[model samples]
Target: MKHYYFFLVFLLFTSCQHFEKQVPSEKELLQKELKAINWKEVDEYPSFKDCDKLGNKTQRQQCFFEYLAQLIQEKLSIDTLSILYPELDTIEVKVTIFPNAKMKFEPQFPKDSVAYDTIKIDSILNARLVDFPKVNPAIKRGIPVKTQFILPVIIKVE
Candidate 1:
């Protein structure tokens, strides 16, 4: 009876040890989750106050882009770009919105287009693109993030 009790106790202790599992550390789990996330896409696009009430992600993004393009077109219409570069009708502007709601606009030019004065155009853009309406930064996993997109600004020279 004593030997049988000792064997039973030994079996119970060995079984309990086998059931013990090594839990992963917090840092390891975090790293794994980070790897699993897709950094290229955001849960929500950057938008303006006017666009916030729109339904669905696609509609909100469309409204934001259209409004921004319209504003840019209106602002630049009074500038001297149409007069300075009469042949240039369209300019691809790279717009970047930071997490803090700051914005930057840079005109993208092709490699061989040297006829237009790049410096003058940049100065004009910097000077003209100001005092824009309030913009909300993009959201990624419920956190604000920076976003960049190329906007084709149509310059109606006529």
Candidate 2:
């Protein structure tokens, strides 16, 4: 009887796999880690000099736009060119800043020959770049990122 009871207890313990813990695989753990991060959003927005003083994100964004507008307007004024032609079309400039704060500019103007020379525009932009202060690039996951901005240099016909 004692031998039979010992055998029965041993069998019961070995046959029951319900208490066994299944270890998770590395792939499963990696999937869970990826899911925890929100890929749609950035950790922080890009900053320009004097714009970072604002405490709120909304204000900071507004300041950034204002700063860029002022900087471009100050650099490329049509006051001298407007006198030559009674009317002039607006110029659209796209500036992209890399993570290292290096700038690349793309100026879009009328394809046809106009009063303003593209070469002069290039020289003006290049000259301003030499004096431009380094901007703080956007941040993602504690890493610096590239940012692009479009600035419209609007000149009134009047």
Candidate 3:
């Protein structure tokens, strides 16, 4: 009877199941991670001079825009431009700052019919950059990146 009990116990133990672990491949893991990231947004906005002192992201961004605008305003002879061409009192300029600190400026005038010295405006904007400190480029996924900003400049006769 004891021998029979021992044989039954051995059979039960042998019948128990075991499973092999399933592991994901490197490609599969990478694809999943890439899809989870926010491609449309940067991890951090570009930093300009004093903007780095701001603690919050929103405030930093605001300070960057303000500082850049102020710098441009100081450098730009808007009054002269307006005086030369009264029609160009307000303009919307799109500025693209590359990771290398290179810039491209595109001005959107009030209307298609307006004509002005665009080259001079562009040159003025470029020259003003000298006063502005070297910028810390935007970051996406820990990599430095470039960004674009649309700034509006309004000149009043007052």
Return the TM-score for each candidate structure. 0.89, 0.64, 0.72
Error of 2 at 113 (Å): 7.8
Best by TM-score: 1
Better of 1 and 3 by TM-score: 1
Task: Give the local distance difference test score of model 3.
Answer: 0.74
Ranking by TM-score: 1, 3, 2
List candidate 1 stretches off by more than 4 Å: 1-12
Over 1-158, each residue of candidate 1 has an lDDT whose tens digit, in order, gives 99999999999988998899999999999999999999999999999999999988999999999999999999999988999898899999999999999999999999998998898999999999999998999999999999999999999765
Tell me the number of clashing residue pairs for each predicted model: 0, 0, 0
- Backbone clashes in candidate 1 total 0
Question: What digit string (tens of lDDT, one per residue) describes model 2 on residues 32-72?
Answer: 98899876555666678788888998888778777776766
Which number leads on lDDT? 1
The 10-residue segment of model 1 with minimum total lDDT is 149-158
**Model 2: number of backbone collisions:** 0
What residue runs in model 3 are displaced by over 4 Å at the alpha carbon? 1-21, 117-131, 156-158
Report how far residue 122 has shifted in candidate 2, in Å.
3.3
- RMSD for each model, in Å, please? 2.2, 5.0, 4.2
